[model samples]
Target: MSLRRRILILVAVVCVLAGVAGLSFLRAADRAEQRGRTQAGGPEIARGGLSLTPGEDGPRIVFRNMAWGPNRDELASVPAAAPEGARTASGVSCLRFHSAGGTGICLQAVKGGVQDGYRAVVLDARLREVSAHRLAGIPTRARVSPGGLRVAWTVFVGGDSYAGTNFSTRTSVLDLGTGRLDASLEDFTILKDGKEFRNADVNFWGVTFVADERTFYATMATGGRTHLVRGNLAARSVTVLRENVECPSLSPDGKRLVFKKRVEGLPAEAPWRLHALDLTSGTETPLAEERSVDDQVVWRDDRTVVYSLPGDFGADLYAVPADGSGAPARLMASALAPAFLG
Candidate 1:
């Protein structure tokens, strides 16, 4: 072959290989960008090539843009509005905003560890701390009512281990509008099967308020069974509604309740399945998320539910269809105990 022809053929082969490598690199970059856009809620620009960008406005990213932060307008359809200046308190374990007012309530551990006590901190719309109550247990959950007039929380106490059998919880409610605090639900009168019942072992947690703000639902455990109990703040009374229901979360419309039902024969560790119960008809519909959900569930809207699971990095939040129609989708990485701020 002529030397010039040989040289031209070699150069052509090199160009083809370079083109292929460039195409491969571009494809990989596109895949990475796609993943980032979906996972982080980051922006995506598609000009000649795809690029990942920051979200212009959404949920006002906080905690160094942590994944568990609620997105913008996430609870717009729901009755509540996100509390302003909610993220000002550092090391918050659980938080919730009222539906209509600027009041925000959160539980922050003194430190990141469970041995340290928690602080139930109230923040105004400007994110300034208004009041704080020193609590004696590890922070577990915090919730605010639709009108921001009421606050509820649960903390784990006297636990040998975080997941140990000896662990107990203390649940409390505060009527912010009236400045009345029910320091503990254990003092309330318990009604089981329409009769007054008293037991020292009775425990309550996971309180979800209804529209009336006077009535709420919570999980009560006694006699080795967990029951869903409806309570009235005015009367200081609780009546068991159904058995095997833990961590009841009321739907936005107040017509249904979502809770975790303990499954038998799983192992030493109790496995719970998410179930939705009709408050009127007493029919229970199991949610599509089959994994063992140990945390209290929250309603994103009327049609969707969100919860958290422990992950390698941190706690992660997930969303599942309320009607058991779809698989769970990861909503935030390293987020647990999510509350909607509309």
Candidate 2:
């Protein structure tokens, strides 16, 4: 072959080889992104849908796929219970039952040998995993709307403690019906004293939604003070209802709110007491179980409240009367989060 012809042919071969290699690299990268790993080292993708029809059996307390009857000792594993054929991802930090039918779970998986962000997993009434979304911060709280059309969560990014300095939180809401996700409540406009309010140090967490999906309640902390505020999801705005409320859980009847109030004359290590506020009468009554409760209270029903407290073994669930009567009674021996399985 002529020298010039030989040089041209060699150059063409090199270019072709380079192009093929580049395409292969791009395809590999795309596959890795799709097959993300769960904290339990399983594929993060959802499986097929499963039947969510409740058994003829009565109501059950569901934690993950495990169901416990009235007798805590009679526990049965129902790993196949997820509706829509979805399974609970491993490394779930929190789980809440959706009133409409389904479950919302927050997974805190580890990536690159460090605590990665959280994943909000949605399961249908049949207990099938339906959708999953990546979220920012450490999962601190997770809640589903009364109708199961909405999911809300709170994550703590940086801070040693709730009352510690230099910590922040992100509260987000997702509309399953609309497939719209609000990653942060900080974007919502705040109305304090009937005027627009904005501040750099504002932080929000502990979101509780009412029966009406458009209206909700959350904790907003700013200027070293925590206030309970009622929010309108449609308007994207909040109106301060009261102050000194950390985490508020709305009553099923929508007539009262149960929350933790910082009690005076107590050591800073544990200074909160559970209290119920009557929304109409504006009366705050402390519950009879006086041990420092540092958890967002859950209303098991109109008259009973459930919460978690730390113990030597782990966090245990307890129940108390909402009307400031009866002592704290232990329900679950070592359950961190408790929600009624609807």
Candidate 3:
């Protein structure tokens, strides 16, 4: 072919490719706009004053609102007695959140040039920033101690892991009272089977604190096995309690723990089954929910527990008997990371 003919063909190819790229960009933008629109039959959400301060309202519940529209992903609240009622959005957004004793731990993205940057922000009762710490990765789990004196969070750092994914976690604990931070739980002493354990691939996540504030529980993974470990803040140590336990949430009375357990023969996409563990008797009772739940559950009461499951609008809250008796019931739609307050 002549040189002029070849040049014309190349220009035609470039134009075709440009058109295809433009069409894809428009489609993506349209999808993003659709997400901002309110979906029919979804929960009602409106902007309003939200406070973590307890005892004013008659038992309210705060959560990350997963509902569609302008308030989506913001910290929201509704009366605990009527979780299905209209939500009041706080306008503060977080990827993961939890609160107790009038304080909140918000794991949120840092909006700006750095797209992947995130931070763990300590918030006051009125949702004001008390302090912020730069995070090294994507935020996953967050918790504030029962006394509100401590906060903990976990972020996903990329890597191929024993759990069969390119995922790893950095769990950190911060003393709100003293402003002291343990940047990674991996820094603490690990006691496994009555001996100090150390490994390069160890990862920790899903922290739950007891009433004493210093005592807590978290999931530790190493060598392809996960264990529930009792953590001591003062001593900076963790003792492995049992194997195959992940995301353990202590009962309100602190006598039992509701956790996710990996069941054999299940698909890797959804491998966990909720189970209640009796601390005194060392008994594990599988809950009635047959579907896999991948959440760190919260105790609604000593007898009941609440957790999130995948839903049309991201996630929904569900409740089940802590004793593994009654069937699971949907508590609220389009909500995640609930914290009950009086």
Candidate 4:
């Protein structure tokens, strides 16, 4: 063929490919829009005046709503007794959230003109933003102290998934009363195996504060194993408690910890089994949940623990006995990161 004819043919092919790409993009956008509308048979969600404080309605469960609708991804609440009922969605949205004593730690995404960013926000009793700190990367776990005086959050700074072998996390703690912020828990002194430990690859995540507000527990990953560490904010130090524990959630009585243990023979993507560890006896009892869970669980009560698993919409919450006796039961659909407020 002539050179001019060949050039014309190439131009025609490029235009055809561009047209197809544009059409596909439009279709995808339309499908996303449809997700904003309520689907039949899905849980009802409505905008309302949601408060973190316990009131006449009694105890309520606040979580990140994952149901497909206008209020999807927003912080929502439902009566703890009727978790499957209609949900009241607050205007604020968070990727991960936890609350205690009328205070909330919300890790959220911020859209920018060029790139998206993440931040940790503190919410008051009225679910209003008290303060916000810009994060370095994607938010993962968030927690607020029992007295509503402190907050902590974790973000992925390097690798993506915690299930993988290589990843980095940045955990931060903030004092709401004093306006003091610990940007990274790595700055604190670490004691492992009865000696001061220091490593360049150490990463910390999944912080759960104790009732005393000075003590906290978190997952510290260094070398190849994960350890449950007890942290002291006043002392600016952490002591390694045990190994193979990730995302430890302390019981109300402070005598036990509910954490995800990596069980042998399971796939790396789903390697964790919920386990309860007795702090006094060092006994670990695997919970009744057969499926793998990759979440930082919350204590619904002294006896029951709640965690999230993958669902059709996004994620769903489930509750299981902490003593490894009863079977796991579905608590609510399309919910993640639950915090029981009373």
Candidate 5:
């Protein structure tokens, strides 16, 4: 071969080797970063293409009115703000629940891995959309404000998740009318992207607000620990109220709170029970000694608390009396998120 041709071939081989080595270094660096995430605890990095864009003025959230099933038939039903034996009929894909003031509540729909990327939609009587908007990726727990001015939810980006199986979840709030999202929740971590969590580390869920709009509460977990936090939004500060509890639902009067507490000897997937807390004194009382409690809860009145319990991939809604005297909670319907408008 000519000298020039041999030299050109040698240069090409060197460049190919360099490129492969560089790629290998990058892969190694990625693995090392993933490993570092295992011990890190801080606000999570936002992922997915969820937008928390700027928008118009905020609107009030009334209890939503909705009918289940397709168009007509007894199987189709509408819900009032308060539960007077409200039952979800079969063949229903989605139903609507109203807030106490009659404004419809907003449900954030999202994918399994990415909790923050959500579409907030209000369902009317026919399971039709009354209004809808997108939001920033926040692993939020929220409630309708007293004046119905806002749907108050906690904001946090999870620090860790089950690695690749988990997409990052963040927390933030939205203006009911304009659909503008403002994320100001304090430090929380989420899973490093592309990693799978063998178990859930912690993600924000469970949102309850007082009728007076004076307080908001939610649960946060990390490093195998769970905590219930009460936030004074007006003050822009938060206080850690307790540990090992979640899915808090406040009573109508805003004096009592209901939630699920992880039990000692129950399956990880379904090991929680209903409990109540007095906001005035921070004293907690068991509302149900059930084998386990469900995931979400809301007050039917000062006397009753309603929540979403996991049956499997899908979940069921149940109501338990705060007074602690009732038949093991009754099934309200085949829904995941439950709210009362009364």
Candidate 6:
């Protein structure tokens, strides 16, 4: 054997080993940063009524129709030194009505690492929280009709099993005063190849109920892209409405929908945005054109649309016109889902 040849082979082997080690190191670093993003708190909070609810315990309803902005003194008294004031310089991320005698309960994030955890506060008609409770799983994003006859939220069981957590979004209904589930969140079936694909984890969360309480809509994901599923409360069945969407936010009149669509061939920051869909026309329009716009929007009226925007200290809240006319206004900062109270 030649010593020179043996030395050259050794050098080649060392070079290959170093390259492999370097690649492994780079991959590990990348995974570390990605894992750090546990959805504990991110743009999702800001996109939804980020500043609506007091605590980050879970789902929150926005008090959008409480006459006007939140009263600082009244809010301070109930939550007492909450880092982000309820609909302060920032806005909230959720909107829902109180069930009957129960005060309006809204969703908010308490802190970081709270994926399915949020705080629910009892708010009076004046938009003041009478009390608060810590919610575990993501509360079904829901809305109550003007008549206050029905309350609806989505439900999913097997979806929770992901990420070592059982996170499911189910649609639940409640009567006004009783405050009990009028009808538990049922399941959805997929008619594929003439067979029923009954999956417990339907990935259903966002829900919108019409005034009639018989028909509502939600969002579901199939084959990586998302779709809208309209389910009739009476029949308990769902049909695909739209595709390539993430979350669908229904309008107050139930005539229009604002949602986040998966913009393919675009940058990652553009996966979600503010989009409006006409139920009767099936026409989609881009309203708030922001690369970073996220869903969880609530309709203050037929014209005003409110969603959360993330900011320093925490996520903030922002609002824009649903008619696609006015510029986005920052209603408050450091908040999540803002539910309305009329």
Tell me the lDDT of candidate 2: 0.69
Spell out the clash pairs found in candidate 3: none
Q: What residue runs in model 2 are displaced by over 4 Å at the alpha carbon?
A: 1-55, 64-100, 110-115
Q: Which candidate wins on TM-score?
A: 4
Which 10-residue window of candidate 5 scores lowest in summed lDDT? 46-55
> Which model scores highest in lDDT?
4
Model 6 misplacement above 4 A: 1-103, 107-136, 139-142, 153-171, 175-197, 267-270
Q: What is candidate 3's lDDT per residue for 1-342, written digit by digit as tens?
A: 999999999999999999999999989756744443346767666677898975466889999999877778999999988899878888899999998899999999887784759999999999999999999988888888888999999888886332464579999999988889999999999999889999998999989899998999999998888999999999999999989999889887889989999999998878889999999999999999999988889988889999998998999999999998989999999999999986
Candidate order, lDDT descending: 4, 3, 2, 1, 6, 5
Show model 3 residue runs off by greater than 4 Å: 1-37, 159-165
Better of 1 and 4 by TM-score: 4
Which has the higher lDDT value, candidate number 1 or candidate number 5? Answer: 1
Among all windows of 10 consecutive residues in model 3, the one with the lowest summed lDDT is 29-38
Model 3 scores a C-alpha lDDT of 0.89
Candidate 4, residues 222-313: lDDT per residue as tens digits?
99899999999999999998899999999989999999999999998999999999989989999999999999999999999999998999
What is candidate 2's TM-score against the reference? Answer: 0.74
Query: Model 1 over residues 1-342: C-alpha lDDT tens digits?
Result: 999999999999999999999999989867755443323433221112100111133332221113322222111111123222222223223433322245666676576565666678776554457678877687776777776678888787766322334778888898887778898999999999989999877878888898898999998988767889999999999999889888888888999988888777765575788998988898999999988888778787799888877764455668899887899987655444555544
Writing each residue's lDDT as its tens digit, candidate 5 over 190-260 gives: 22233322234444555566665656777665566677877665565556667876767777676787777
TM-score between candidate 1 and the true structure: 0.72
User: Which residue pairs clash in candidate 1?
Assistant: 59-72, 80-99, 81-99, 81-342, 82-341, 82-342
Per-candidate TM-scores read: 0.72, 0.74, 0.87, 0.88, 0.57, 0.57
Candidates 1 and 3, the one with greater TM-score: 3
Tell me the deviation in Å of residue 31 in model 3. Answer: 23
Clashes of each: 6, 15, 0, 0, 48, 74
What is the Cα-based TM-score of model 3? 0.87
